[model samples]
Target: GQAASSLGSDGSGYGLAKALKHSVTCIVPALVQLKVKAHPFAKASGVRTEAKVTALIDGKEAASDTGEVQITAYGISGIPVFQISRFIALGLHQKKRSEVLLDLLPEYSEDEVYRLLVKMGDKRDDLTAKGWLTGIFNQKLVPRILEMAGVRIQTRVSELRKSQLQAVAKKCKRIILPIQDTNGFENAQVCAGGVRTKEVCPRTMESLRTKGVYITGELLDVDGICGGFNLQWAWATGCIAGKASVMRKKK
Candidate 1:
């Protein structure tokens, strides 16, 4: 007996296998790549791009750069900072910028971050701080570290100066926004651009555009964020489409 099979998806065919002559819908998971940008230290000089920074003077935007500041590294869906860092790093090709500006750290208020750094300085030796910083930061740049930590000048500490603080502030004020590649299927766990859902009947996974044709799984332009959602979508849609296709033969 001859058997007819409808292809929903394969491990890697979700994107390329949309060539079915019948009424077809494609399900591509949304693939998001980490945006990449140059590290702060990688800049040739102090030329400033107006858009890249929050310009926080006292937890508020500086007078020069205006508009709302975006904070990254904040939790997504109740995920903690440590966990979010993992994703961010993965997106960034494991190349985390060594100098993260203070404003980017959303967990602490501006004042609290400065006080914490001061306290850290008090408890630890400055040489030890420099040594410790060298490990995590690029080029052993102390001023940049201080600026990232939101530390300015301390009258009590004779070693730190106003000019060095200003330099650090300038360098640490901005981070380049990462650029995402047009296609992220290679790195993405799920593909994004699929058949537009509007064309498919949600109830039966049948093509509203073409009669009696069915679509299901990752072929129907349905994708969800990480978790079991994509799998669930595949299971549910596949079942509905399969049942509908079978029932159509009897009619």
Candidate 2:
């Protein structure tokens, strides 16, 4: 009865029908080599699932889930994980140990951050007054980051003197967040660690380690800062690798 009612409802049934039609017409065709399977428990719960499996890159043992984990196609993805992947890939290609060194705070000097907070209190009569910070940071993050920096939100910006302002500036610039772990292969968009360039010819992307083994894409360990940089790296590396691979094959 509930299923029948849901099918008859315009808001529910109409939208669902449209989605089904689009999925069938568009999505099905794109999935050329796709595989599907259902667990009995998941089927009973009406849940559908798809999994992409990839081998562990570099042969490092899998990490436990205690830390932050983002799964991806090639491997894990995250700030610390991404940064570390560059060195890891190079090391792996050279058959050396690969590990990531993460810094929780990259920006500020500790003494500078501390001195700034003390000045804010000395300049402001009312320590709780809120002042001008919108120009310096996102308004939403300002209050929270300020609180972390030991400034009361109610403190007036006018109360901050030069030293205090400088201190606050340093803290804002150097907030620390620890790296937990990489988001694993399933959830990651690209792999971090791969073949090292020291062992690969730079211009051609030809492997110095193995003949005919041209490394490219995320497996090469070159990643860029956020935005479209990573995509550009992948495209350039892939193009070079493709050209080099063909040349190697001919030779």
Candidate 3:
């Protein structure tokens, strides 16, 4: 966000500029990084879960991830979401329709979900429609799911109709949200593309096509997920390039 811009993402891109001048080829990844944004679907935020999340481009599943899914004010973020974010970014880059489907009750079968909802709906208690699913989902998500199922929060769970329970079951298994855009480079963990790797000597980090010039860090066509490899690559290559420059100067 604001923090990223302050870190000198001023958009001058001097590294890529220099690479361009040197005529080094660069293969940009389909995306840099993404914690995608989407149109508002849920009435609440701060929802988190570990389940199956799939990114669909043009109504087809391109990528899916499972682990943690964090619901942000803008859309979604997390390692699992991040895993499939490339497809989201790629689809958007190509102007294709992009959507993300969440299986809130992934571990349970559709029939199991329906049976559970029916069981909960029959229970008479202080639990309102909002809290009916509290035993099944995060408290914040309960209302969101009910809202998606077209139920009022104040409605009593015991009064839930069979059709309403079925709708809830369907939503529990599949919640499709239309993606709008990603949080952009500023929020990305690491850029996916840079100068082509083959253009530089691996050991010296010096440009093979343009001697006396060196490339390092994001300037090289290398990127890693959330692992420290991205930072390590930047550090290691920068050190190699620095040493190569020193040696040339001494000669």
Candidate 4:
């Protein structure tokens, strides 16, 4: 009788009603705040400058003397030309120099690439010579690569001789675009240059110069091509630094 009566009681029903009301009241305002913050720059244009960054780590003094800074729409701040901010930060902490060299294209051999283009032309005689490259490369990139190779887009594929094909292929693959400079710190998500890896222990990420100083993340002279490789490197180095720090504390 008591169990049956409890099911019909208003007390239990009131408690459930109160819980639901409280949940919605708390959740709705929080959601509204998040949405407002997420679109802070919905109407904003251009870049915002950030405060000058300077730090001292492990007895090393590092500063952004250029006083240059920039922030992105997502609230992330960095410099454009120095995309290696993470590495710079790490180096400053470890008292090391930060430097980076970027090679725009690392995969292709110039001579071999040229040969492939030459072969493509010979193989596809029926297609418009200029349009023959549509299968091998993006339409947008075809013209650029051809220009670098000194090949005319209008030339018939059938007209391409072995030597010409070789030249085109070489240019497509070995188009050397030198990195004059990287986007500075404001636009850069991480620093390309940092403490030399040779001086730091890869296993632990501990600095050789200072026993208690641990270097990790973008601070080391290791970079991966675009996509998530840089973030992966950070995660890996962070783990190594954390473990090493723990080990040092244990001793």
Candidate 5:
């Protein structure tokens, strides 16, 4: 109540979605790529090269192929399983605690999960179910208690895999993970390695592999790191391609 009162009438809510949209708009084209030289200075050279990193813009290759260039990656934004489950349970149990438990109890429609919880009687809170026949796993009961068995059985009635849970965690759009080359295509900021640029006419940006098709954006093999160059490339190439598509004989 004190915290709510302190908030006053306007409320302090940040427009995350809006901020993201603006950021994406700014970053879509000028993407930057970080590259590290494997060996800045060979031992034979007798002097270290300082091992500096170069920011490669999309479309343009590294200035020097002299060194081994590697793309850098960032860590994923993932919530731990225990913390996620705790918060989920808290939100679900917010109003009328006992009634919430009763509501959740019926959610475990499967005979096995239902029977397990009923057999445990008053210790039903130790188990959680989400309906459907999936799988049952063992879990330790919360709170330090003696006489009560420490081992408790847990069954997730929802048929969701670990990958699915991770996907769901990202769906909320609140979590942010660094875009990396090793991450799944779904989690990537922009996809790389599409229609080979060699198969496309540099003058027209039209595909030679599949004539009449003009490729642009992340769909092309061209990708940049984190600047607006990608967007600039897209616009420049798209403009030329668009003009090429409707080329007419000089009359």
Candidate 6:
């Protein structure tokens, strides 16, 4: 805000524009990843796997994606996590709580997971509960799953009660972890908030609030996800603003 306003972007000349208080109109962690206060039972050193990730704000789904979620000691990364980071960043900016729900077994329904567990229980009663799941789910995930379900890792599957199996099934399908914040602006590939787009002319990229001033690219309140959308934005807006400014000079 300071950087743009310093260049007279705060509508200094337009009597129609008042000197306004600055606030984030959208987000800051666009194309970045989220940081989390991962549950102790859900912590992983550096594991990578595919899952259906849902980011929530105040218990409502704000964003979701299905892909690789890289679990670090601190929190999650990878593209799927990046896809939802903007929502989390915005939620945090508004002082609202955010969360992430991971479906490690995206292909299976909750009931199907329970049935599979029962079938495995019938055949692998001799193996420990953790061992039984190790063959089915990722070995790296068994400990965390069992831990999340409140089951002891070494308990024999034969010793497992019906309720415990149900609990385990639920955890596998929906492991919800609270998000603390984003990885911060330094880690963002591109940012989302700047000059308000409503204050600029769409055709010319000139500031409606202050004539002859053009705001474009990351300088405006626009951003995009991965795969060069942001790159295209920068180029297109720069061209429009540049051309308009030149045409005005000729006039």
Q: 124-226 in candidate 3: lDDT tens per residue?
A: 7666887678867788777677878998988887777889888988999998888777777666665555566777888899877777888788656566655
Q: 1-251, model 1: which lDDT tens digit per residue?
A: 00012232344443333443332332222323232234332331322221222212223332122222322222111112111222333333423332112233334444554454445445443444344334333333444445444543232333545454343334344333332221233334455345567777898988775677776765655555445787898889889999988888889
Instruction: Report the candidate with higher lDDT, 4 versus 6.
Output: 6
**How much does each candidate deviate from the true structure in C-alpha RMSD?**
11.4, 17.7, 4.0, 20.2, 22.3, 4.6
List the candidate numbers ranked by lDDT, top first.
6, 3, 4, 2, 1, 5
Who wins the lDDT comparison? 6
Candidate with the larger lDDT of 2 and 5: 2
Q: Which regions of candidate 2 fall more than 4 Å away from where they truly are?
A: 1-128, 131-139, 149-170, 182-189, 226-229, 244-251
User: What's the ranking of the predictions by TM-score, best on top?
Assistant: 6, 3, 1, 4, 2, 5
TM-score winner between candidates 1 and 5: 1
Cα deviation of 62, candidate 5, in Å: 12
Error of model 5, residue 88, in angstroms: 34
After superposition, candidate 3 runs with Cα above 4 Å error = 1-3, 14-38, 122-128, 154-163, 243-251
lDDT of 5 by residue, 120-226 (tens): 33333433332211122111111101001222124332333444333322221111111222222223344333445666689887766556666655445565533
In order of appearance, the predictions have TM-scores of 0.51, 0.37, 0.76, 0.38, 0.29, 0.86
In order, the Cα lDDT scores of the candidates are 0.41, 0.41, 0.72, 0.44, 0.31, 0.77
lDDT of candidate 6 over 152-202, digit per residue (tens): 999999899999999999998999888887776666776667767778899
Model 2 worst lDDT window (10 residues): 24-33
Better of 2 and 6 by lDDT: 6
Better of 3 and 5 by TM-score: 3
